[model samples]
Target: MLTMAIVILLLLMCATIPVAVTLIILAFVLGYFYSDFPFYLAAGEVLWTNSENYTLIAIPLFVLIGEILVRCGSARKAYSIMDAWLSWLPGGLIHANIGASVLFSATSGSSVATAATISTIALPEGRRLGYSEGIFSGAVAAGGTLGILIPPSISLIIYGIFTETSIPKLFAAGVIPGLLLAALFCFVTIVCSVIKPSISGQRAKYNWKTRIVGLFSLMPLFLLFFVVVGSIYAGLATPTEAAAIGVLAAVGIAAAGRSFSIAMFTDAVLGSLRTTAMIMLIVLASYFLNFVLSTLGINEQIEALFSGMNLSALETLLLVFCIYIVLGMFIETLSLMVITLPVLAPIVFAQGFDKVWFGVVVIILIEMALITPPVGLNLYVVQGVRKRGSIMDIVVGALPYVLAMFVLLYILVIYPQVALYLPNKV
Candidate 1:
C-alpha cells in the first residue's frame, strides 16, 4: 500500500498536478483500495476541522501583515538600513540582504513573501554594485527561508498544530536557532566573497553617524516583531490575537509612512486571500491524507520497521534527516511538513526526543528546502525578481547556505540545546 501510494503521488506530481489536488487524489485512491471506511465522509470531517482551527487564523493575518509591509515600502527601508550597517561586513550588501531577511522574517511568516520582498529591494542594489548574480540571488533566497524559522512563523504554527505541541514553546525554540542560521548564512557569504573578490561587490564605507541614522529606519519592523512575538511570550495574547495585533501595527506603520490607502489595502487583502486559500487547501488536503494514513496503519508499519531495525535513537534521527533532505529537494516545504509530520512525529516522540526540538530541526530542513533545486520556492522567487538570470544561478548560489543548514542539522542532533535552551528558559 505504501509503495502504491508513493508511486501514485509521484506520477501525479510529475504530471504537474497541484500539491493540494495530488494529496486529495492520493487519499481517495488509498481509501478506495485499502480501507472500508467512507473516504468522502472522512474528507468532509477533515475540511470542517481545518476550517474551524483558530490557530490557523494566524496564517492569513501574518500574510496580510507581510503584504502591507511590502506594499507600504517597509521592505525597502529595511534593506537600505541593513545595507548601511551590515555592508561593512566582508560580503558587502549580501550581509544586508540576510540581515534584512532576519528582521523581516520576524514579521513575515512566509518564505516566499520574504524572498519576494527582499529581492525587490536588494536585487537592484546587487546589480548596481556589480555583485555576483548567483551569490546575491542565492543569499536573498536562502536568507528568506528564515521566515519559517523565526518566531511568529506560520510554518511553526502549522507544525505545532499537527504535532499538538505548544505554539509558544515552538516559537521560543526557534529564536536562537533562527538567529544562528542567519549568522551562518552571512558567514558563508563573507567567506565566499573573501575567497572570490569579484563576488564581494563594492563595499561602500559608511560613517557611524550615517549608520545610526539608518538604524532609525529599522524601528518600525522591530516594534512589529516585539508586539507580535513579545505579546505571545508575555502571556498577553494568543497567537491568533498576536496576529491581529500585528495586522493593526502593520497598518499603523503603513499609515505613518503615508502608504496606507484604500487601493493598497485592497491589494493587500486580495494577495492575503489568495495565499490563504492556497495554504488552506493544502492544509485541508493534508489533514485528510493524514487521517487516511493513520486509519490504514501506516504509523504502526513505521513503528514496526523502526523496531525491526533496532537502531539507536540518534541513528533513527539521522535517517529521518536524510529523508527530509531528499524530500525537501522535491516537495513544497509546507506540503512536505504536513504530509510527513503525521507519520514522523510519533516516531521521534517515541525515541525520547522533544517535539519542540524536532520542530526546530524540521523547520531548518524546510529552510533548506526553500533554496534547494527542482522545486525550491525561494529559488524561483529570487529568480523572478532577477528577471534575467537562469534559475540555476540561484540554485548554485544557495548551495553553500544549504551546506550551512546540513551543518546546523547535525549540530542540532549532537546538541539539542541549541533549539531547546530558549524554550526551556522561558
Candidate 2:
C-alpha cells in the first residue's frame, strides 16, 4: 500500500493538478481501493480540526512580518548594513549575503522570502563588484534555507502540529543547530575563498565609525528577533502570541524605516492572506490524507515492516536519511513533509527517536530540498534575481553548501545532544 501510494502520488504530481488537489485525490483513491471503512466521512472533521489548530495562527503572522519587511525596504537596508560589517571577511561581500539572510530568517519564517529578499539586494552588488556568479549566487540560496531551520519557523510549526509535539520545544531545539548551520555556511565560503582566492571579489575596507553607524541600522532587527524568540523562550508567550507581537514589531520597523503607509500595510495583508491560504490548503489536504492512511493502517504496516527487518536504530536512521535525500530531489518541501509524516512518523518513533529531534532532523532535510536542483526553490529564486546568467552557475555554486548540510547532518547524527541541548536545558 505504501509503495502504491508513492506511485500514485508521483503519477498525480506529474499532472497539471495543484499539489493540494493531488493530495486530496490520492486520499480518495487510496481509500476506495484499500480501506474497509468509509474514510471520506471522517476527513471533514479531521481536516477541520487540523485547520483550526491555534498553532497555525503563527504561520501567517510570521509571513506578514516577512512581507512588511520586504515592502518597507528593510531587507535592502539590512543587506547594505551587513555588507558594511562583513565586507572585510575572507569571502568579502558574499559573507553579507549569509549574514543578512540569517537576520531575516530569524524573523521571516519563510525560506523563499529570505532568499528573494537577499537576492534582490545582493545580486546587483555582486555584479558590480565582480564576484564569482556561482559562489555568490550559491551563498544567497544556501543561506536563505536557514529561514526554515531558525526560530519562528513556519515549517517547524507545521511539524509540531502534525506530530502533536510541543511547538515551543521544537522552536528551542532548532536554535542551536540553526545558528551553527549558519556558521557552517560561512565557514564553507571562507574555506572556498581561501582555497581558490578567485571565488570572491576584492575586499572593501570600512572605517570603524562607519561600521559602528551601520550597526545601529541593524539594531531594530536584532531587538525584534530578541523580543519574539526571547518571549517564547522565557515562557512569557506561546508561539502564536509571540508571532502576534512580531507582527506589531515588524510594522514598527517598517514605520521607522519610513516605508510604512496605509497602502503598504494593505499590500502586506493581501500578500500574507494569499500565502496563508495556500499553506492552509496544503496543510488540510495532507491531514485528510493522513487520516486515510491511518484508517487503512498503512502506517502500522510500515512500522511492522521496519520492525521485521531487524535493523538497528542507526541503520534505520541512515535509511530514512537516504529516503529524504531522494524525495527532496523531486517533491516540494511542504508537500513532502505533510505527505510523508503520516507514514514515517510512526516508524521513526517506534525506532525510539524523539519526535522533537526528528522534527529538527526533518527540517534540516527540508532545508536541503530548498537548495537542491530540479525543484530547489531557493536555487530558482536566486537565479531569477540574477536574470542574466545560466541557472547552472548558481547550481554549481550551491554544491559546496550542500556538502556543508551533509556535514551538519553527520554531526547531529553522531551527537544528538547538539540539537537536543537547548530544548532539554530550557
Candidate 3:
C-alpha cells in the first residue's frame, strides 16, 4: 500500500500537480488500501486536528508581519544598512544581500517573505550595479533560508509545537548557529569574490557619517526583533502571542513612517491570507498523511530498520540528516517537517541528542530545501522576481551556499554545542 502510494505521489508530483492535493490523494489512497478506516473520516479528522492547532495561528501573524515590513519600507531600510556595513566586502552588494537577510530573518519568520522582501529591495541594485543575476538572486534565495533558523521563527515554533519540545529553548538554540551561518555565508562570498573578481562587483565604502545615518533607518527592525524575540525569552509571552506583538509593532512602525495606507493594509492582509492558506492547506494534508502513516506503523518500521542497522547514534544521525536533504529536494518545507519530525524526532531523542540542537540542524537542512531544484520555495520566489533568469541560474548560484550548509551541518554534528550552548547557559 505504501509502495503504491509512493508511486502515485511521484507521478502526481512529476505531473506538476499541487502538492497539497497530491498529499490528500496519496493519503486517501493509502488509507483505503492499508486500513479499514473510512477514507473520508480519516481525512476529515486529519484536517480538523491540524487546522485547529493554536500554535499554527502564528503562521499567519508572522506572514502578516513580514508583509507589513515589506510594505512599510523596513525591509529596504534593512538592506541599506547592511549595504553600508558590508558593501566593502569583495562581493559588494552580495554580502549586503546575505547580511540583510540575516538581519531580516531576526525579525521575520517566513522564508518566502524573507526572500521576497530582500529580493525586492536588492535585486534592482544588483542589476543597476551590473552584478551577476545568478549570484545576486542566489544570495537572496539562500539568505532567505535564514528566516527559519533565527529566533522568533515561525518554523521553529511549529516544530516545537509538533514535537512537544520547548519553543523558547529551540529559539535560543538557533541564535548561535544562525549567526554562525550568516558569518560563513559572508566568508564564502568574500572567497568567491576574491577568486573571481569579475563576478564580484566594484567594492564600495561609506563614510562613518553616512553609515550612522543608515543605522537610523534600521532601528525599527531592531526594535521589532527585540520585542518579538525578547518577549518570548523573557517569559512575557507565548510564541504565538509574541507573533501577535510583532504584527502590532510592525503596523506601528509602518504608521510612524507614514507608509500605512489602507491599500497597503488590505494588500498585507490579503497577501497573508493567500500565503497562510497555501501553507495551511499543505500542512493539513501532510498532517493527515502523517497520521495515516503513523497508524499504519511506518514509524515503527523505520525505528526497527534503524535498530537493525546496529549503527552508533552519531552514524544514525548522519544517515537521518542525509534523508532530510534528499526529501527536501522534493517536498515543501512545512510538509517536509510535518512528515518527518514525528518519526525522526523520537529516534533522535532516543539517541540522547538535544532536541534544541536537532531543531537547528533540521532548520539548516530546511534552508537547503529552500534553494534546491524542482521544489525549492526560495528558488521559485527569486525566479518569480526576475523577468528573465532561468530557475537553473538561481539553483546554480545557491550551490556554494548549499556546500557551506553541508559543512555547517557537519560542524553542528561534531559540536552540537554550537546549537546547544546558548540554550544551556541561558
Considering TM-score, where higher is better, how would the candidates rank from best to worst?
1, 2, 3
Better of 1 and 2 by lDDT: 1
Query: Lowest summed-lDDT stretch of 10 residues in model 1?
Result: 42-51
Tally clashing residue pairs in candidate 3: 0
- In order, candidate lDDTs are 0.90, 0.89, 0.86
Q: Which structure among the candidates has the greatest TM-score?
A: 1
State in Å the error of residue 203, model 1. Answer: 2.5
Q: Put down candidate 1 lDDT per residue, 75-180, tens digits, no spaces.
A: 8888887888889888899999999999889999989999999998889988999999999999999999999999889999999999999999999999988998
Per-residue lDDT of model 3, residues 1-426, tens digit only: 545766887798888898889888887777778889786765776688778878888889988998888888888888888898889878999999998998888877888889988998888889888888887789899999999998878789878877888888998998989889888888888888888788776556789998989888788888999898889888899888999999999999999999999999999999999988887887788788788888888778888888999989989898998899898999888878977898889998999988888899999998889999888999999888887858898888889999889889989988888888888876
Give the alpha carbon lDDT tens digit for every residue of 64-162 in model 2: 999998998878878888888888889999889998998888889999989988999898888888899899999999999999999889999999888
What are the clashing pairs of model 2? none
Q: Which parts of model 1 have CA positions greater than 4 angstroms off?
A: none
Predicted model with the maximum lDDT: 1
Candidate 1, residue 179: the lDDT equals 92
Q: Model 1: number of clashes?
A: 0
lDDT of 3 at 287: 80
**C-alpha RMSD by candidate, in order:** 1.1, 1.4, 1.6
TM-score of model 1 vs. true structure: 0.98
Screening candidate 1 with a backbone cut-off below 3 angstroms (N, C-alpha, C), the clashing residue pairs are none
